[model samples]
Target: MLLRLPTSVSETQEYLTQGAVPIGGATLVWATWQRDGFPEHAMSLRDLPEANTIEPETLGAAVVLNRIDDRVPEVLRRAASTVGTGAVRRTATVGGNIVGSTLRCLLPAALVLDARAVILEPEGVTETDLAEVVAKRQLLLSLRWNTPITSNYVKAAAEPGGPSPLVVAAALHAVAGGGTLLRVAVRSEDEVFSETAAYHGDAGETLSTLWDGSLGRLPVPARELVGRQVTELLARPGGR
Candidate 1:
């Protein structure tokens, strides 16, 4: 396998145009390579300092998951912590988690936070919603979003600290009309439900509906447990 380390964004883009798979932390790529065989060419983003910085409202694509857990909002920090253990978080990049698989713990938090991805294209750099970027399979440069007033993330898995069957993230913010704006996103292996709504005071019912819709197909007992977890998260004072 041929590996090319690019120090600049333009160089990375050039290598990508030549069909080199972009490698950040390589946690997912390496796993896939073990089964599918390594690709003919790969571009490493580790040397690109520009893609490794974590700012208040932006996270570079190459930033490690550990850094995100340390520096981002509570909801994202919780999600990042759930990605894997310390060893895995040390090697997993934010970009890798975002683009690697739909089951990533961070994606639901990102969705509820309304994060946008900065993409580096052959033509130029562009900013777009995370969902749009995922749909188009664009090359991500960074992620940007404003912090919400309160946010929480929860994951329900089959085993302790195992991969989750359901992940939920919710954020609450003050709206212009003296109401609270609640954004919730739920993700499972087969479906994703992301919605934002305004509520006068309490948002319990709306949140319950969203949770039911997202996990309705699961077994009754499993769905009930998820519902209880969501309720506990929403009931926490100061959004925990």
Candidate 2:
């Protein structure tokens, strides 16, 4: 197998056109390889400095998961923390977490935040909605989002710090009419894909409608439990 190290996005794009696959941290790449041998050519983004930095509104695709804990909003930080143990986080890249698996906690957080992705393609760079970018399987350059008024992430997992079977993330923004706009995203094990929904009204009403409309498909008891958890989270002072 040939591993190509590209130090810049342009170089990465060039290599990609030559049938090279871009890999960050290689967590998912290695797993796929374990199941179905290595590819003929692999491009590693580890040496690309531009892909590893975190800014106020942008997070580089190659940034390690652990690096985001304190640097980003609380919802995303909390989601990042649950991705795995410290060792796993140290080697997992934000890009990989976003694109590698939709089941991860970060995807819901990103969805609620209305994050967009900077994608690098052979043609050039293009910006697109995070969800759409993931659906297209585009090579991610970075993720960008504006800070929300408040946000919260809640996950239901089989074990402490284990991969979550269900994740719910909500972000709120104060509207001009003394009401709050709420965006919620839910990911569950039983579903083939995750979904995000939005509502605007009194917190209680919004939360109720969100639960009833988006999570209604879930069993009644399970839906009630998730609804309560999200309600309590948003009800906290300052959404702490």
Candidate 3:
């Protein structure tokens, strides 16, 4: 396989347009490669300055997980902190996390933020909801979101050296006309079990409508734990 590390977005797009894949962190790459095999050509975005930018409205695709700090948002910080051990956190990239299906710790938090992604492809740059990016496993350039008001996150225990924990994350935001909107997500290891709630008056209404009784499908232990977490999270100041 040929590996091309491009330093500019234009160069990167050129390579991708020619059918080269983008690789970041290489954590998921190595594993998937061992199982499947390598692409004919791959491009590393490490040298692209745009891939490392971190700001309030944007998180670069190659931004290190460990670099996410308190300034971003509590829910995201909490999720990033617990993605894996220190080594994994330092090595993992936001694009890798979003693009690869292996790890999903950040998905719940990102969903609750109502994030959008800027994507680059053989065609050109396009912007869309983050959910679409994850679904299609597209090349993500950056993630963007409005700053949230109040947010909370909870997760199940992770085994040592394990993948992401089961996460239930929520955040509140204000809409026009002085009203509050809430976003909520439930992510298991393999799939996102619940659709993100887009602030339905209060937690109860949101939960009832969004969950649509799907909580009953989880194993007893998970159901109970997630149940407690949902209760506590909504009961806090944000839900009302």
**Local accuracy of candidate 3 as per-residue lDDT tens digits, 1-240:** 898887877888899878987777877788778789888998777778877878876888888899988778788888888776799888888888878845577888888888888888777778888878888888888888899877777778877667556777777787888776666677765667655445655656666654565554666665566556656666766655
* Weakest lDDT window of 10 consecutive positions for candidate 1: 207-216
Candidate 2 C-alpha lDDT tens digits along 1-240: 899988877898889999997777787678779899988998877788777778767788888888885567777888888877799899988888888765556888888777889888889888998867777777888888888777887766576545446777777755566655667777766352333334443456655665566566766655665567567656766543
What's the ranking of the predictions by lDDT, best on top? 3, 1, 2
Q: Rank candidates by TM-score, best first.
A: 2, 3, 1
In model 3, the clashing pairs are 182-199
Task: Tell me how far candidate 2 lies from the true structure as C-alpha RMSD in angstroms.
Answer: 3.1
**TM-scores for every predicted model:** 0.84, 0.86, 0.84
* Superior by lDDT: candidate 2 or candidate 3: 3
Off by over 4 Å in 1: 160-164, 176-178, 208-240
Number of clashes in model 1?
A: 0
**lDDT of candidate 1 over 114-157, digit per residue (tens):** 88898888887788889887777677888888877778877776
Question: Is 2 or 3 the stronger prediction by TM-score?
Answer: 2
